[model samples]
Target: MQRAQRNSLRLLQWMMAASLALPVALFVIAATISYTSTNDIADREIERTLDVAHEHALKVFETIDRSLAELNEVVRNLSDDTIRAREPALHRRLKRLTDSLPQLKSAWIFDADGKALVNSLASPPPALSFTDRDYFYSHIDQSIGTFIGMPLTPRPPYQGARFFSVSRRRDSDDGNFIGVIQASVLPEYFESFYARIGSDPGSFFAMGRADGAVLAHFPRLNHDLRLDPGGPVGQQIAGQPERGLMTIAWPSDGIERRIGYRRIAEYPIYVSAGLETSAIRARWFATMGQHLVFGIPATALLFLLLAFAFRRTQHLQAEAAARREAEDALKHSQRLEALGQLTGGVAHDFNNLLTVIRASVDLLNRPQLTEERRQRYITAIADAVARAAKLTSQLLAFARRQTLKPEVFDVGQRMQSLHDMLATLLGPAIEIVTRLSAEPCLVNADAGQFETALINMATNARDAMQGKGRVIFEVETATTIPDTPAPVSGNQGFVRVTVRDTGIGIPAARLGRIFEPFFTTKQVGHGTGLGLSQVFGFARQSGGEVTVTSEVGQGSTFSLYLPRVPPDLRSQRLAPNTAPAVAGSGMSVLVVEDNIELANFAADGLTELGYNITLVDNATDALAELIVDANRFDVVLSDVVMPGMTGLDLAQAVRDRGIGVPVVLTTGYSQALSQDGAAGFDLVQKPYSIEELSRVLHRAARLRRVRDGAAE
Candidate 1:
């Protein structure tokens, strides 16, 4: 009997191992599979990214190549000053080219002895030397095709300046080396273009020569052009494959990178899109994290299930059954609580958003609305829609693709605009106080986000005071980091905003977690716990920081720090929104949207603007329309989120098929878009007005022209 009992126990133990560890092992395998699959997908994405970088690089190279070809044509028109009347036309053309392509720094002609004949520079050089230049030496045979040269820093009036020139060898009728037409490109343009590519933090995209000269990189701000082709980067890419993926560490900052590199077929250059291994690993682990949450519990449950199934021998037994049950119950309770919290937030915020939108709609329907009042109503409606979309996006945890539109704005003016809005939002019980800077605090930030941050701070203050105490809002200028007990910077100035509330102050320990998501001191159902988190994130993302101070009984002060740009150096990017809209004038528009109401809205909008519309349900249909007769449409306007295929896929399809129609993608909130973001296609965020749409369409048409003209 004793031997039989021992055999049964051993059998049960093996059964338990098979039940529990099998699932666990399967989970590990599944996770590994997921990681590998995700990596492959990421590599595919890297290919798209490489293509984009390649396109941007090609724009410059093609521009220079085309300019050289045209310069040759103009020289043919010249014929040794007998047709010198065309000289003025040639200079005008070069100037126009410079204007059209910002990257084309200067275009000039040289004599046989390497003396300047004509220059596109504002202050033209009377004479210039190319005797020592590679572009000159390489083209000594006076070849026709374009020749690229190593970067050079010329001396004199343009001192300490560096540029790369693409030159075409000009020759005599006898095929003797005469001179060259060179178009110098400012490398800074690469940095500018790269910045606009909008790669994530710590990720970099670069365009360089196959020999590994880094033309430009992002977050590499305001530095003199640096070029070293013989460096490590050069050694890795120089004379490398036409396309490849490699692991490398840049000497500038020794961060390991998985680089996706492709050599441009049109030019002797390569483009690299690098994502750090840490980021990739983070994404992989995050996927595994989700699986583990469900996988471990399921595995343990299997163990319990197997034990219960084989109860006859009393063979299988759960050692920590009680403990595990409690843990499972706790996890279940936590998940329910989280679900309830999320649902409540969605319900409450949606109600508020709906109320705002409904009110705006009612106002917009006013019969006797003045033009000014009509504009205000329209603006209000757009704002409400944007707010509603943002709230919904937050519920879905979708990231926003649109960046902060930082511009110089007077804080005093903004405060005046907010006064009435705050008064209404905070209600009657809270006493409002504004202590603004006397010398008009000018700040650089997304005006809308800044306003939202202020309102959030005010809302928190009102809540803390239980709607019955004073809430003080102050804006001041500071030359140091705010409230940091330690020195963090070397006198970097900030436009500081402080929100002080007279309320039940926070405890010493709990103060540390105030900004954490879903952490709130308020009673259940009263708070979504994301208010302060938004403010904190916005501040940090705007190249600033936030700090807080509280005494148990003395109330709390939340201070937000935003970097201050010097008045003289502030970017002049704030264009007036009064540009006259161009009527479509029977121009054909293709509308691709899944939402019937949104499609109708777009169709009606274009119709009002005097355009013909062809509506499609999804990307597939849109592609079909384009494939059938792409020239039938001037622009394709599509919603991002659709059933069959997304707007991004459609835009990509349009490009892939080599269709020449300009595509405009519009979106409210899409997780896919928030992550991968808009490809080179123009993106007009939801809640845009007819005027905004017009502007983007105009811009898109211009871009299409530039792209097609380049192709030709």
Candidate 2:
């Protein structure tokens, strides 16, 4: 009886051991199956994403190409010699063309002599010549369907922005080539398009042009993310025509991700999609856990019947999960790398603008003037200085360097006040029209800045007309919602003020850069190219935007959109105050300036104004004159930028020598000299009318007297 009982116990122990081992083996098999399934899904998702991204990218490229084609067609039709000779009508057509296609910067017809017959910009330069351009030479063949020129800076009547020119030869019925029709397109158009791909939160997209130029991206990466086609991924990209999945470390973010990249076969750009490794693994892990639960029970039965099947399933799951995670990480990195390159380029251009403003201001203060014309000279000098100050302010705003001071006001009323001034400024040749809304349109903005912007727009319109054309000013109000179609490109809800002109229209080529500072189509002395730039800065600073539309001949329109302001906060209008005059007790003054003609003119004006004047060309001579007889000079008036010493330096020197005379610095460029550190000195800007100069001098004299009295 004892032996039989022991045998039963041993049998039971063996059975229990088998039950536990079978389940463990089955669980391993199930986990392997789950990982394989998850990997397959991940691969399929990657392929789909890549395919979709490529298709979308191609669509964008095609749209741009179509726009370019339309512009080329317009250029071809307008380049005829007969059409060129017809002034006003030919100009109107060109304006219409540019107005219809806002993307074009500027368009023009170059006659056989390389003279511009028509230009869409404000004023086509006199004696304009472009016979030496590569596009003109290449188009001479006439066989090239459409000649696309490399990126270059456009010559006058167009400035501030770089553009690529598209040209086609225009021929008469006799197969004789007349001229080349060329259109300019801004690089920013491509940048704007690429910015709209997707908002996948943690995920980002990127595109690279054929020449290894990183075009666009999402989640704004820093400058270091540029992808070099000579690099590993770039090499891989070159080799593959179809969609691909790979693991890559994006140079910009330095994060490893699973990446899917596809070359846009029809276009010159490559599109990429990226997924984080953590995201992929987390998804796979969840799927694997669920599979393990079911697989363990099933595998236990299978292990009892077949042990080899369970071992194979376990191995497959582990391998699949690792592969998927690696691929996703690589794609994310590449996209970021491409984005960094584009941002860097934009930053570099912005810095260049700052440099130009700084240099121009320093040069303005070098010229000399006389006492009588000092006030007029000072007013002209002040105008330029003020613009320079505005430029720095814009940079600060763009960089988020300054705090905003927004206020509420009626946009319509403000525009109405500007209309009278615009009418006077645009002149008789250009008909001025107003289409203001009857109901008031409120907006939040800086009133003084807004007025300046309005004036700038009016001036731009006047230039577009070349002293003859029609300018239509209109204002309207509307509420905006998310995803709604914007009235202008890259804009949202705001008050829209449209300034349209029937002058020479902007070409599609030069349309994008009209707002860039120093990018002007006017002759060098005719315009500073800062008009639209100031408008852009003011709009942006006030939480608004400025968009432009133009055609080569049809015309150009600028639309300013400002955020709506509540009624209660509008600024009260202040009456213009008359400037107080300085009560000089027949004191002698010293005037220093480098330009002889201006200096002589100023001295004559001051003599007429009953002031005794001693003129010098620079700060050194003025100081010498003062040292020879300190009592001879009541005040030292000097231009800021000079060869020997700056105006500020001279002022400091005079103070150190115990000369108690007042110093007034005059300049054309004020950006460098208007900072807080340089604020104590009196300033007068260049290009001022005679009356304006007198006002500033009087104020300076009065301030000096007050200071002198306080010292006594």
Candidate 2 shows a clash count of 75
Candidate 1 at residue 53, lDDT? Answer: 82
TM-score of each: 0.40, 0.32
For model 1 the TM-score comes to 0.40
Report how far off residue 49 is in candidate 2 (Å).
Answer: 59
- Top candidate, metric lDDT: 1
lDDT of each: 0.74, 0.65
* Candidate 1: residue pairs that collide: none
lDDT of 2 at 116: 74
Residue by residue across 246-298, what tens digits does model 1's lDDT show?
Answer: 77775556787777888877677777787777777788888989988987788
lDDT of 1: 0.74
Off by over 4 Å in 1: 1-336, 348-387, 393-445, 462-496, 508-530, 540-545, 561-569, 572-583, 620-629, 642-645, 652-660, 672-681, 687-712
